[model samples]
Target: MHVFLPDGKQLDLPEHATALDAARAIGPRLAQDALAATANGVLTDLVTPLPEGAEISLITKKNPGQAQSVFRHSLAHTMSQAVGEYYGRKGFPKEAVKRGVGPSIENGFYQDFDLPEPLREEDLPDIEAIMREIIGRNLDITRADVGKAAALEQFSYDPYKVELISELPEGEPITFYTQGEYVDLCRGPHFPSTGKLPTAFKLTSTSGAYWRGNEKNPILQRIYGVAFASQKELDEYLERLEEAKKRDHRKLGREMELFTIDPLVGKGLPLWLPNGTVLREELTRFLREQQFQRGYQGVITPNIGNLELYKVSGHYQNYSDSNFSPITVDDEQYMLKPMNCPHHVRIYAAKPRSYRDLPVRLAEFGTVYRYEQSGELNGLTRVRGFTQDDAHIFCRPDQLKTEFLNVLDLTVLVLKTFGMNDVRFRVGTRDEGGDKYVGSDENWTAAEAQIIEAVSEVGLPYSIEPGDAAFYGPKLDFVVRDVIGREWQLGTIQVDYNLPERFDISYTGEDGQEHRPVMIHRAPFGSLERFVGILIEHYGGDFPLWLAPRQIAIIPIADRHNPYAEELRAELHAAGLRAEVDDSSNRMNAKVRQAELSKIPVMLIVGDKEQEERAVSVRERTPEGHKERKGVGFDDLKAELLERYQTRA
Candidate 1:
């Protein structure tokens, strides 16, 4: 049989030969270094037989994906064996504990266990000692298949594994891996031995999780651990974790007295504090001004509407479970609006009839509610009552491409203004096996084609996500990576063919006939609250000059300089800048420190020397220090700060 290498070179080999065997044929050195292989771009164990005409590439320790998976999987087994030995040393039988599944996740691995008693936090160090001892033993690892009956007998003491064995489909292979006295049911291309694991692995934390993710099933104790291919990588990951914790939005929000979430009130309902409300309003006004410049008319609607409204829009049929239950009126049922699309559709359908009025864009910063599960609710990412920066464009069929391109331009503006340069897009398409979306296939094709063309014409970096579209139509989403490299979905633009049909929307055509106007749904910021939450963390509570709740903080070196500080504050306020004077009875150093902690973008220190000269000493927060000062005329300072504020970032 023939196979192709990554470089497009073809090689003849024995039919059904294993990847390891193919590696040996390539070169003795390659076979020695090959940890795994990717057959036709799909990662697989080296023991798996390669098919004819497949593209195979050997994976080594330098391959991040292969190296991390191999090390994390091995760490799980090592931790499991460590736990068993720890219990044995405490005079407990090995059979007293049963194991659940452990697998490599995105950043690490976790093993679940069914124990007689919950493992305490203090038990982790002892287990680590045992894991180190096992690593020092350097036991060789091997893999083999076993019969279902034999697997069940070997794991009889572990009901979890026995259950797993019983659930195996007929004629399916059950694989196992053994190292030292530990054996686990795993399909793996593990490292050659225990010594191959990085010495930098560490157990992170423990949590309770339901078996098989079913809440009704037995709760198992889960231990999470992280492993890296090198000590430098491990140290970097640990440092990032610490930085993430320090900049966690929930923690900073509290410290800055911004927002609060009370369990007694509700799980996902966040109450904005006075300071947070100021921030939210600033963002709303900012977007509102931009929308006005881009030809969007503001509109308002009620928070709750009749149930039939959503049913007609197809949201109630598909997303009913995620919404709040219908409110029982005296003789009818009404539902709290879970989305603004249905309401926006009603507005469009009200008194519309001309092609000249085509491409009508209506926008709203409307707040919607959802019933998010308690466990899924994070700070602002997942919330019940949050506002969306939503808008809908009603345009002629021929105008679809232009409208989509316009929306894309607006989304890019939002990203660039916030200094988020690493923005990528995803085009979501319909799933063939899923519902056909109760619209004509012709309409679906037209909408999908328009989206593809518009995105392609923009010449931006993007990918396609199959089966990720809305039920009504295909869409494109914008995602941005934060400072620590976590991707967040920030904006979306969707083309809908079903909504116009459902709402019976039509406009008079130039040929004197009624024609359906294609609808484009867009949210540039997704949500002001959520975006600000991400921004708070992304900037570490140090907002840009314009977006800061207090743009400038004026500090007076002595009580005598308070008048000069207040005078400067009044001038900035008159110029439409959010400026404040520090009137606190504290030392000059303390006042400056407080302003820095508050993250006021620009600080002006007024002493007798500066006050007499009608000037201010400026200190801007850069990644460098603040001791470096620049003196400028008060008028010049105001002009420069205003320019930065208007341009943002």
Candidate 2:
């Protein structure tokens, strides 16, 4: 059989030879380093027989996808064996520790087990020691295919494995990988042997998981671990984990008193405290001004609309699972708006439009609700109720690309304003043969092409993702990397022909005939709640002067200087700044510490000298330390604060 290499070189090999045999034929070094292989873009294990005339690319430590998955999967198998061995040594039979599925996920792997005795966090070290010992044995790992009857008999004692094997389609090969006495039923692309697996792994934690993520299914203990190619990488990841813990928005939000989730209010519904509300208002004002300057007219819509509106938009059919149940009002059903576009569409359909109103942009800071699962809800990033800085542009077909580019520019500006400089784009197009999409083929093709062309014209780095588009249209999502190197999807712009067609909305063209108007759906800040959550983590709870809820805290040295502190705060408030006076009878040093802990950006100290000079002593927070500039005139201080607020410095 002839097989092609990645470099276009062809070689003849035995008919049923595996990828490892192909690697050996190419070079000994490649065979030794090979972790997995990709044949015609499908990842496969080296032990799998290569197809005739296939295109093969050997995956080593250099490749991100297959190498990581292969090694991590192998580590999971090793960990499972270690667990069984540990139980066996403790007088329990090895068979008593039944293993469930173990799969390689991003950055690590996890395995589910049904053991006679439950595992605890304290047992992780002993398991690690056993894993290391198994690795030292350098046990050979091999795969084998078995028929249904043979597989069922082999795994009859393990109910999880039996259930999995029973569900396998007929005529499909059942495969299992074995290392020493530990065997797992998996269709795997795993490393050749235990010795080849990296030891730079640490079992992180244990949690309960249903066998197949179903609540009705039996619960299993899941052990989570992270593996890296080298010790240095592991160390770096651990350090980042520590930093992430400190920057967790949920923890920081409570400490800063920004937002809270109350049991009475229900899960996934966040109540913004006064401080968080200020942050929200400032962001809304900034975006509203930007939209106004760009010729967008603001609009308001009710929080609940008739169910028929969503039915026309196809959101009801596609997103009902994630949407709250309909409300029965006078025997007619209404739904809490899951999106703003449907309501905005009705506004466009309210009156007949003309070609001269070709690009009608309607903007809203609209709040919408969704029935997010409890497990998926985080502090504010994933919420039941949130606001979107949403807008929809109705334009002539000829203006599609231009309108898209304008939205793209606005999105870039929003990201930069938030100091999210590291940005990437993804153009989500429909799957070619998928039935889930609602629009016609021609409309899908045209909308996707326009998005790609607009992104190309902007000269932004982007990749195409199939099957990631919304049912109604293709979309361009802006993913930004935060300060801690975590990526979040913050902004999106989508083009739609389906909604306009479904609603039969049109404008009178110059030729005196009606024409369908294409719709461009965009949200620079996808959700105000999510955006604030990410911002909190991005800034590590230390916001910029303009965005800070409490921009300044004035501290008086003694009760005698309280009047001056109050006066300073009044001046700051008059300057359109959020300021507070520390009149709680606390010492100046304690006041400063409190301000620092609250992440207040600036602190002004007032004393007798400053009171006489009619100035304040400014102490500003910096990366290095508190910077103190003494005897700054009150006028100068106000001007500086105004400058930072205006320029967003």
Task: List TM-score per model, in order.
Answer: 0.91, 0.96
lDDT of 2 by residue, 1-649 (tens): 8899988999899989889999999999989888788888888888999889999998875653447777898999999999999999999986799888899887899999999999999999999999999999999899999899999998888999999999999999999899999888888878888987889999999998888877678889999999988888889988888899999999999998899999899999899999899999999999988998989999999999999999999989999788899999999999999999998989999999999987999999998999876667889999999999999999999998888998999999999998999999999999878877897899998999999988888788899999999999999999999987888998999999999999999999999999999999999999999999999999998888999999999999999999888888888898898899988878889999999999999998889999999988889987677799999998888998999998888
Scored against the true structure, residue 222 in model 1 reaches a CA lDDT of 96
lDDT of 1 at 632: 74
Report lDDT per candidate: 0.85, 0.91
Superposed model 2: Cα runs more than 4 Å off: 27-30, 59-66
- The segments of candidate 1 whose C-alpha lies over 4 angstroms from its true place after superposition are 1-16, 25-28, 62-67, 120-129, 147-168, 214-219, 435-441, 627-632
